[model samples]
Target: MHLFSRFQFRDWLLANDPALSRLRMASRVTLTILLVFLILLAIEAFILPLPTAAFGLGIVLSIEGGVAVRDKGNARQLVTRLFGCAVSLVVVAIAAGLEDQRVLSDLVFLVIILLASAGRVFGPRGFAIGMFAFTSYFMGAYFQPPLAELPEVAIGPVVSVLVGHMVRAVLLPDDWRRDLLRSLESVSGRINQILFKLAALAASGDIGEADRQELRQLEDRLKEVVLMAETFIPRPSAGVFDGASNPAAELAIRLFDAHLAAESAIVLSFQSPPPFALVHAVIGADAAELKRYEGMIEASKDQPQGETVRALLWLGEARRQLTEAINRGGACGFSGVDAAKDTAQAQAIDFSLANPLLRSALQITLASAIAMGFGLLLSRERWFWAVLASFLVFTNTNSRGDTAMKALSRSLGTVFGIAMGLVLATLISGEPDIAIPVMAICIFLAFYFLQVSYATMTFFISIVLCLVYGMTGVLTLDLLKLRIGETVIGAAAGTAVAFVVFPARTRGALDAALARWFQALRELLGAIGEGKSGFELIALSQKIDACYRDVTVAARPLGSSWSVVTRPGQIRQTLAIFLSCTYWARVLARSYEAPPADDDQRRLITADLALVDDAASRGSACFFIKRKASRTAGRHLPVSREGARVGLEMVGSALERLYPQADTLPFASGEAIARSKQG
Candidate 1:
């Protein structure tokens, strides 16, 4: 709970992230803005011809690119940023051209909203580009110039993106690759420290709950580190670093793989307490092996005698490999070639013309078209705001609940922002001397809160707009009120489209996520029953993490109709059962579950465990669908000390409880509709 701890900080992000990482991000943005503001001041002092207000957009675009920079990934990362900016520029210019024609302009605005919202089908970056492009269109339309000067005005915004990034590079010169490596190096050191602690514990022939918790946390952290490494590591010969000099690509890959191996070894070593004599022997053997490692974790032909010794040797080998990878310099002897293949390289993006996407695109496009027509009938000048609102409202919504969530946030935030903007406008009405400085503070805040809180970000955005309008002699209370009105109309239109066009329920999405987890859990149980290596369980853990993330996302918008679903704590209780069962299943999978003494014993245990798996999978499906478990598959599992049998019972306890309650809850919609009619 320490505010500054990077681990806890990451948990604070709306999207899960490490804390120091994003705070550093906020600082980088703030510094970049300050620098941009200084440069503009100097330009104005020198009576520079360029529009200072116009340069604001450019600086924001460029600094925004800085937010994505990573270690060893300078080349491709920059290309993506520039591509985003390039596309955004075109979108704005097109919007500029549409500004003169009344009826046509509204059509153009609606089309932009549709295109931008549909871009979410491609993924996060695409969504960012779409959102930026759509917003930029509003900027361009608002700052429309004569055809003669339009190209000149466009240059400022285009160049500003570059300037922002340049400022960031100068201020935060360390870059992400170095920062990421430092993080890995830090984790590696902690791992070595932990291994040393475990060896000591083994020697003492004792392991406490505290020591065990430390090991578990380390395991969890290592998994996160591996996932983090994969995200930023450029592919083999991908040339993220300067061409032909991909110095650290292989090194990073080995770091991840070695860490994974070491993680498994550590967990396995701690799974069962070993005797003092055996632990003492392992320490001696480990020391001897360390001396022979010679900075390389050579797979040895000599077999270790005891289980503890074997795990210790694995740890030693993994540590050696990591040390070698870390030490090997540019084009050194360590061929991290195998490391490259394990990391799945990126593939071409293809958002197929498929349903959900097709339906979503149709809904947004049609809804915006209607919103635009309504806005145009009201007033052409203000219609842009209406279309902008619709674009923001529908951009990333997956269901009616999500749409309503966004609509309410957007409308409420805009209202608050407008009111705040009015107050600020009144204060700065005649203070030309302080206006620019105040604007600079607003600019810094707007970018700093970009992702932390949407409502807060919108509040600063309104302030920035007011400051800009004041400078341009366009600030007016009446205009602010008009924007609020237009935005409200757009929100209503967008929300209506969401509910009427595709009425998706949060419960359904949650059910789909649960189904995914069930399938993965079933596979994992089968793997454990079949006695697969525990190291392979990492893949299943990743699958579970993905499913958990989906559940979290689905749950966020559930407030829209959750009252219509099961009672308050029902879903959570079911989830708790699922999580506990899976945790134990994973633990069981990791254990060196000694095989049964006879074929009959093995078959009997496997059948019992399989029934547990079946009951779990079916029970979950039935819970979501509100139906009774038809096939009573499980019985009192034969109690045994063999790991597999014991694990089956551990997992079965939850499923047995789940089966009885499966038919209790009905779909919220049926009940919700009835209540709505009565009201």
Candidate 2:
């Protein structure tokens, strides 16, 4: 029984994470390397030297940027891989030419770093190429390969790229449609799982702390599944058809609606002295309805176009039924205080920075220079370690706080890695049999946690490095200590430069994110007011969701994570407002799908929408200009439309949440919720 429970928990964990997908990719990369080596051995071919083998592995790991490029044509994937190979070879050749002159080599290496970092302007492919270039330069400087050996060294990357291409194009080619269907099924299954848990809790009429934590975990997992589904599902094709007409967009909305329905159900389950009987009944019904929809969706995966549309309609109806059930069980009467549970934000890489990339490039280049200078003083041979650490700290970081946090994570990871590496090296110093497998496990774990935790990935990578040294007969305490020292110097240098040169404060970024979120909300409000219900509304809704995600990410440094918050309550309220506004905005956008039944209803909705739109506009203005908003503390917008009334009530609730203490200005009037009977 215990074993079954453990297996069930393991399955639950896998369903919630993108772990299976990541594990598959990791396995593919690992197997590609193994197969390439095996094929060469079988043919009695000249084996690649260690340096070149590592180069090939790097190319295979990063060239296509993982699953992002999986859907591209074979030719395109080949071109991308070749581009990475060519960049690495050219960079290495340049490094070989400059190796004879130390002063000149360092100067040129910094320039290469700047350009490589700045290559992000072109997008993901560009970033991958940049990563290859930087890694190649570092390898060249570290290996000091003679120019005569360049041709031989180039063979590894070429072979690696070709083998990787084969693996992607033939061995395990991605079928995006199939993957999308699988992700959709995963989302559906997780929702059903959560609904079942909620039903059980309601039936038992006992919501313990353990149950709450489990529910939150389930919600978080469902959130991951939904995000993955959205990513796997292709965007609506650009054509004469509006967004709403695109079947893909409708399917995405259905996923979003399903997530919201599950979230609402969770909130209702947590209500005090709640409607346990009705909650159990409603959730039981929702689970059954969702199960039926899942069956149809699964069947549609193999059918023609019309079947997908029919399946999407059924999915939407299932979501609608669940939502209506929650509403009837007094969703609004719960006061929604518990509804603002923290939702994890996906990692935000600031690729939108056209000019900021250049600035970051410059900053990273300067920090790398500082790190190299000090690192050489520690150990000339391993100076590149510091430089690599410094350069990486700047990647995917927007604000100075992000840089600082990343630097801290890198430093702490290095410390932990050093400790573990020392112990492992001591125990497995002469055992290649065990060392090799341990190294492989480290690589596997590194990739598995690569997206989940930077520190954990770094720890595994450090272990691999230590094992490599052990196998090479150079494992020493001095070397490991040097690694830690250089890493700290590099991290400190990067963090210092981030704060000193064109510092981007986390608070400023948070405010900017909030501003953008409000601006998207305003646009969504405008669409709602104009009665735009097709693709336009969907587009705006997506934008709002995107902005909300950004806000959550931006607010991270201010939360409990880094201990930067001076007012924890203020931070909580800020996040709560973000969650509430996003929820209500989505509810409003999705609910206003039809025109008003008559002119009386139209006028009421139009008037109430105007009021809310104006408030959104004002909210945008306040955040954009960083000024106190105009107070409308006691004013009201009477509404006869149910949706409009609910929206106004949410606005009032949000304002109260914001200005709980004093007579401070708010995003809108706190008393605008004047609910009236339907006329």
Candidate 3:
């Protein structure tokens, strides 16, 4: 196989986007760290006493904590940061006071771990405070600072908070609404470019495999752009659109629909290449129409005629809609749709042991304690690294399978990092000048790719640690070996705890995610049938999007050949079918216009949708009970008027096709489950 084909770099690039927000934030963090380091260096060199390691870690942690806290207003954000600083200060003082009592300090540390982990349930602000408290306690434990030195250590966090504020609010400020609009504008230009390409390809009358692959990549690119835009829509800063019909959101929705139209045209045009003459005429007409709208050129007299024109007409209409919305400042709003309300919900802290957050906290605490015991046996001073490793393993995991995968990735990353670290350490050879700049680069790369790849991030982190050791003149083969050993033990402890203590099986998680997806689909379908507003439709679609992600993550283990599931293929097939349904759901949401005018026709379509709902419920329930889904009631929706019928047909077909494959899964039939329930 060709190298490019084997790697499919084009597809991967479109899929794993280094989104603007992540890149921007990473830059800010890097600049903040460098600036802070320089200022501290000046202070420590000629002024009062300041511990370099203590101050460095404190500043990094404080900046991260402040950045992690999300609020709509700067003043509110500042207050939240100050509050977190206060909490961390108290935590530091307590930790310092308890430094002489090992047993008490250990107990206090675990309590802080449990509380901090559990605090995430309250949301971003809580998570920020939790991070600050935990990091402060860790710093206190690491430095073993006396009460007299507390004041100097406290200065680091205070300076960090102010400097981070300046960087975020003044030096590198972000306006989410402006950025979102700019992105949409960029996407619009890209879509136009793609349309131009497709038109040229249609005129060629011969689309090859390479052309098809390029089109596929372009489609994926558009999808990612839409997903990227979706991320901005949920920010608290986006409240500027509230009560004003959320022009940005409507624009995003229209752009997404236009993308779908363009994609459809490309697929259909390539499937059976259109007449070259007709393709040229259609392009001329579109260009003339655009110029006429701009008052730059007169309208064309010639009209493009052919059945193939239908495939291309939707693209033109989508373009016109997008262009009009942009030019008119989005005045052509969803007529009856009220401005979308903020969907942010406050999640009350769940203290119950059954809560996932609580369970995760317990699991991490146990893992950390176990690793702490074993890590001490390995290296007294570096024991905390193992504990930190165990905590990190459970950071974003939702299931035992997730924990297992993360642990494996961490261990593998550490192994690779050791080899690379040794080589780099030998090259640098205790030269602080070379090691310092290299360490800074590693930090930047680590944060930049933090969301892109966990293993890569871990690898860079390992390199940074090695460089740190080298700078401190403690670099050795034995120390490197100890690092890897402690990492493995920590990872092993985390994985074991996840499996043995209140374990969440991947299969169960997949089932729950599927149920949520089905529920979201049902709600969206019902809303479409009721002639609901576009705002509601967009919101519902967002819910389906979220549920789809959850399903994808939850089903990942089942897709692996090493999955412990008895019928991995069966589950994989089921998931593929679910994805198909999800695509159709998106199609229906984009295509919906209005219900049929005739009462009887409307009633019939509603009945068809009812069947769609029943199919969704039954299919989801089968997954819940580990039974095969039986055949659905029908194959398609009743054909109605052109406007809503297209959507109705797509949705009906998706749900109808879902049943048979679901029935083939390696489990008892739906009828058997029903009969057992009856008995």
Top of the candidates by lDDT: 3
CA lDDT of each prediction against the hidden true structure: 0.56, 0.63, 0.66
Top candidate on TM-score is 3
Q: Order of candidates by TM-score, top first? A: 3, 2, 1
Worst 10 residues of 1 by lDDT: 631-640
C-alpha-based local distance difference test score of model 2? 0.63
Candidate 3: tens digits of C-alpha lDDT, residues 1-679: 6887855543343234423556566677777777777767677788877865357555666447435767655676677678877877788888889988977887798889888888877776777778777778877777777888888777777777777777777887776654454455545555655666676776676777556546645654565566666665542343322333555556666766676666656545554555554445444555764333334212321222222345455566676677666555434323423334557666666678868887888898899889988988998777777877898899878889988988988998888977887788789976889888888888778777777677887898789888877777898999999999999999999999999999988877876887788788778867776776445565676677668767767877654551233332455445544544555566566556554234533543455456556665564443333334322222221111242444444455445445544545432322332343346
lDDT of 2 by residue, 1-679 (tens): 9999997775565574543676667666666666665554543346544454344444444423453333246787787778888988898888888888977888888998988888776666667777777877888888787888887667656666778878877886765554555566566568767757865775676877557657755765676676676665455343112444444445555666687666545543454312343334344455564455555544534333223223233334555543443343233332321121224344555654446877788899999999989998998789888998999899778899889888988888888977898789889989988987887777777777766677887898788888878888887888888889999999999999999987888877877786687677667656665667655665576666677677767767654442233222445445545555565565556556656334443444444444444454444232222223222222221111354445544544563444343445344432332232222
Clashes of each: 7, 2, 0
Candidates 1 and 3: which is better by TM-score?
3
TM-score for candidate 2, residues paired by index: 0.77
User: Each model's TM-score?
Assistant: 0.64, 0.77, 0.78
Clash count for candidate 1 is 7
Error of 3 at 225 (Å): 3.2
